[model samples]
Target: MKLETLSVRIGRDVEPMAGDVAPAIHMSTTFERDSDGEFSRGYSYARADNPGRKALEQCIAALEGGHDATAYSSGSAASLAVFSLLRPGDHVVAPIESYHGTAKQLRDIIGPMGVQYTFVDMTRADAVRAALTPATKLVWIETPSNPMLNVSDIEAITALSHERGAIVCCDNTFATPVWQRPLRFGVDLVMHSSTKYFGGHSDVMGGAIVTREGGTLSERLRDYQGTAGNTPAAFDCWLLRRSLTTLVCRVRAQTENAARIAEFLSTHQGIERVFYPGLASHRGHDIARKQMQGGFGAMLSFCVRGGREEAFAVAGKMKYFTRATSLGGVESLVEHRASIEGPHTVTPQNLLRLSVGLEHADDLIADLDQALASRS
Candidate 1:
């Protein structure tokens, strides 16, 4: 079955709960073996495995149209598991404007671990090709790239990388499973900071990895997920699992709110630019439209007529849209990106990124209107 159809129907098929009713929380740290010092099922323990985590993983794997999935403590943990696949002296190529934490991981952390990397502007597929080397083990992609909203052409980069026997890893955080599924684009792996959209409520901090087939890749990742000792707690796993039930609905609503807000901001008197893939004015709008389902995601950014001072006042003045950093929650969040990163960071001073929420569109618009008017 297709992922969209399966996302709504996958976890319900299992008889894990009584008579196929709502699933209960299994907070077990360990499980008993049947006999002969051998266990008889797919799970053994909470650290290595848990029934709750398994349910979520299976559902997520089905959503990504992959054979297997593993859940982690955070998106960073999931990414670290993929990075461990690279050996010392291996080469990695990633987008220059990808997530900042991911960039730090490659340059400051993994690079010191003897891994070499080249940060190229991913909007240029040719640049990715030019950076390729025999040691290139992976190409990391972040579509609708962070902060600035630049998108990469996954089909072109993934196809080129595959020819050289390198894996393609896409961080599908910005475009949730609801909007984009990278596996369909021939990506080798799909991962999510499930903490964002999958959890849907911003209450759980977890990550997940999905692969096309369940084999060595699955086993290797599971081994790392276990060894790293960063697996999500049973409670967190259960929370995330519960969040899955409303994933589609919440994302759809948030996307709708985002589209309305983006449209308003696009031609607003005091706004200079809006960076939403949903907008036809966006450079990535066509590619995002071609590859994505439904709406382009709830996250977006817009620059004010003035720089940092004006952006800060705009962010500070919002009443309904709370000024916060993390996104993908039931409530709206607004942030001054450049302030969060300080002086040395890449986020521009004039930019304000928003995580649109389920609030009434008029209220959100009111908040924005007052905030922008205050700046004017």
Candidate 2:
């Protein structure tokens, strides 16, 4: 089946007893055992496994063409689980311009746990190759990277990492499986903040990790999840599965809106640069074109003509786009990237990241036009 068909049909089946089209939420924390003392139903504890979460994990794993997957309470916990796979002295090579939270987790959390890391410009294959060491256990890729929209060549990076015995994991939140599938490009693992795209709305919080070959890594993640009890609640998992049904439709409309808005920003006198992989002028356009199927992405970032204060003025003037943080929601959002990342951030002072939503393209373009005009 095509992705559109799989999106709606993968995790859903008619309930046996209820005969309901939509699956019911399995909220039970424990399941009954047989008189002979066995869990014949394949689940025994909520923390270890739940019907709702199992459905979601199966859905995402199939979407990404992976062998298996595990759901988490949040994207952070899922991320931590991957890092937890490494012991003290394990090294990681990561993009210099990734989501701030990922970088922070490595620096503040994983670093103290005795792991070593090197931040490199992932767009440059040479830079990534130069950073690898004998100790490197993982290579982290985040293409159409947060705030910068830098695209990494997944096939190239994967080959480089694999040659050196490193596991390649990608943060696929920005470019969901609808746009790109890292496992197909030789990535060992694929991760998502199901809180964003999978939920399709801003209402739920969850994360997931899918494995390409389903070996020790997949088993380790499952073990860590059960032992640590960091998996999402039953209701959240059920909601995520429900939201997956419309993922394709919502992402397509939002990507169209983003392309239009990006083009408008590119030509505006008040804007300095628009960071969108779809635009021919972007540095990573060629690679993104090859890796991303239907569109670049709904998220983009632009720099104002002047400095931070001027950028804030344009954001404050926007009528349709809300001045806020987080992305992959039903409503559009604009945020001053540097401020949100804090004083130690490397993001430019003038950059504003936009999460284009399901609004009509003309309306979003007009709102941006007026907001840019306000700066003049």
TM-score list, all predictions: 0.95, 0.98
TM-score between candidate 2 and the true structure: 0.98
Each prediction's Cα lDDT score?
Answer: 0.86, 0.92
**Candidate 1 segments exceeding 4 Å error:** 1-5, 13-20, 342-344
Candidate 2 lDDT over residue span 1-376, tens digit each: 8888887787787888979899999989999999899999899989999888888998999899999999999999999999989989999999898889999999999999999999999999999999999999999999879889999999999999999999999999998998999898999999999999889789999999999996799999999999999989999998899999999999988999999899888988888889999999999999998999969889999999899999899899899999877889989999998998865588899999999999889999988888888554
Which candidate has the top score in TM-score? 2
Off by over 4 Å in 2: none
Q: Quote the lDDT for 130 in model 1.
A: 97
What 10-residue stretch in candidate 1 is worst by lDDT? 11-20
- Per-residue CA lDDT of model 1 for 304-354, tens digit only, reads 989888888888889988888778899999988777664446777899999
